[model samples]
Target: MKTLLEAHNLSKLYGNGRSQVVALKDVSISLFPGECLALMGPSGSGKSTLLSILGLIIRPTSGCVLVQGKPVEEDERSRARLRNEFFGYIHQEFAVIENETVEKNVMIPLQYARIKPSRQERQSRILQLLKQLNLDWAVHKNVSFLSGGERQRVAIARAIINHPSVILADEPTAALDRKSAEEIMGFVLSMRDQGCSVLIATHDERIAKTCDRVLHLVDGRLL
Candidate 1:
């Protein structure tokens, strides 16, 4: 399989000198389409830090991220564009706008991509995604009215609205019960089967077992 994302000797640090904190130290990994990799580690073990770098949310202090085998530098404008175009994120918090309708939220990524999709097209996609994620009732409802799991699903729909090549999930199952977690995991796996490479940062044993591969991080390094 062709690699879709690669981290080369990546490292990150906060502050400087005695006050510095080494968040990630020389961590590297690669992911390809049709694969789901689970990232496991204790808190402050650099799992989230590495995910943030891979997702283009934060720039590493050293090393490079290559998307499709090409190095991606810390160019704010282009990096932001790459993130918006090729990467989808399912944050632990399920970052949904409380005031926005589910349809509007899902449409945000497409709008950011400047596709100028017609209302019909947007609605069609939103409805299809909602049904796929079993969130149809949320289509026209305000996000704040939904439960946590529902909100997560809605956020997921929005992340995938643009059909991004890669999905980065941060503790996706952290807040859900067993059944709901399994359902969400099933949806995530479905995306992998559909050719979206997935990288999930999690400590959930069930999630780790469900992954095609597991990348373990310890003390800022891949173990």
Candidate 2:
């Protein structure tokens, strides 16, 4: 498969002198088309840091990111555009606005989408994704009123709304029961099959094993 994204010699650090903290150290990884790559490690093992850098949410203290064989500039404007155009994230906390209705929450990305759709088009697309994620009936419900599983599905719906080429998922199934988790993963794998690359940060061995390959992280280093 062709390389979709790559992080080379990544190192993220916080603080300075004796108070310094290392979130990642010389880490390098890649995502390829039509694959789900698992990134597994204990809490605070730099999993999220790595994913955030790859998602273009933040820059590595030292390293570079490449997309489609070309370097991605670190300037906020360029990175922001790339994120809106190419990346979708399923955050562990289900990052939807708690006070917002499902319809409003899912439409957030469209505001920044490179190919902005009309309000009518956004509604149509949101409804289609909501239906696929079993969220159609809850379109008017505020996120805070929904259960964890439902909220997670809403997060997934929001993630894919822009039709991103790379899905950056942070503990995607941590909020669901077996059945719901299965359904969520099935949808993710379906995305991979459709030529999207899925990079999932998870601790569940069962979930990790389901991916095409798994990379283990320990104490800010890839193991």
Candidate 3:
């Protein structure tokens, strides 16, 4: 199978000279279609940095990211396009708008879609996904009123609403209880089973065990 995403000799540096910190060092990784890969490491071990680069959320100080075997240009427009069209990102912090309704937050992605959906179609799709994630009841509730698990569910619904080719999750289960974590993983893995490549940065052994492959990182380098 063709690789869905590839990172070659990637490195990210912050600051300069004596004040500089190395976030990622010469790390290379790949995600293939229909596969689930786990990135396990301690905090500040570069898992988030790698995910950011792969998802085009940030540019690598060095090296390149390829999609379907072609190197992506480092232009803002191109990056934004790829991020919206090809990548689904589930952030550890639950990157949802606290003031917005659950339905509105999930519909944000659809607005930027390459071929924008009709207002009616967008509503139907959001409703269907929220129902699947068991969040239909909170469709009109403000995000700030929801609990951590509910917020995470809203994040998941937003991430996959665009039907991205790759899902990049950074410690998605970190803030959830065991039951909620399992539910979250189930939703993510279901996407993988349906042919979306998945890369999750996690500290949970149980979560790592469920992936098709696992990679370890320490001090910015892959082990």
Candidate 4:
């Protein structure tokens, strides 16, 4: 099968000279449709950096990212368009707008969506997704008022609202209890089973074991 996303000889660096930090080095990987891949590494080992590059949130200092075999341009507008069209990135920090209502947070992606939906249609989709995630009751509530698990679920709902082809999750379960983590993974696995390419950056062995394949990183290099 064709690869959904590919990172070729990717590397990222921050700062200069004595203050330089290597976030990733000569790392290359691929994600295939309908597959779940886990990226395991210690903190600051570049997993999040790799995910950010792949998701088009940041550009690698060297190397390139490709989607469906075509190199992605580094232009901000182009990158933004690609991210909205093909990727759903779940940040480690939940990245939800704390002051925004759950419905509004999930509606953010749709605002930039290629084919903008009617207001009624957008609300309908949001309501349906919140219900599926068992978060319908909190639809109008501010995200700051929800529990960690609920916040995470809101993040998940927001991420998948665009029906992205690739899902990049950075430390998705890091802050959740075991049961809540499992619940989050259940949703991720469900997406993979339905043909989304899922890449998760995690320290949890059990979560890594559930993926179809696993890659380890150390000191910014793939091992």
Off by over 4 Å in 3: none
Q: Which residue pairs collide, candidate 1? A: none
TM-scores of the models, in the order given = 0.96, 0.96, 0.98, 0.98
**What's the lDDT for residue 127 in model 1?**
96
183-215: candidate 2 lDDT, tens digit per residue: 888888789867789999999998887899999
Summed backbone clashes in each candidate are 0, 0, 0, 0
lDDT of 1 by residue, 28-133 (tens): 8999877899999999999889989998998899989999999986669898888888999998888889999988888898787756688898889889889999
Model 4 per-residue lDDT tens digits across residues 1-223: 8899998999999999999999999999999989999999999899989999999998999999989999998678989998987998987789999999999999999999878999999999999999989999999999999999899999999999989899999999899998999998998889976679899999999999999999999999999
Task: State, as a TM-score between 0 and 1, how close model 4 is to the true structure.
Answer: 0.98
Better lDDT candidate (2, 4): 4
**Considering only N, C-alpha and C atoms within 3 Å, which residue pairs clash in candidate 3?**
none
Indicate the residue-level lDDT of 171 in model 4. 95
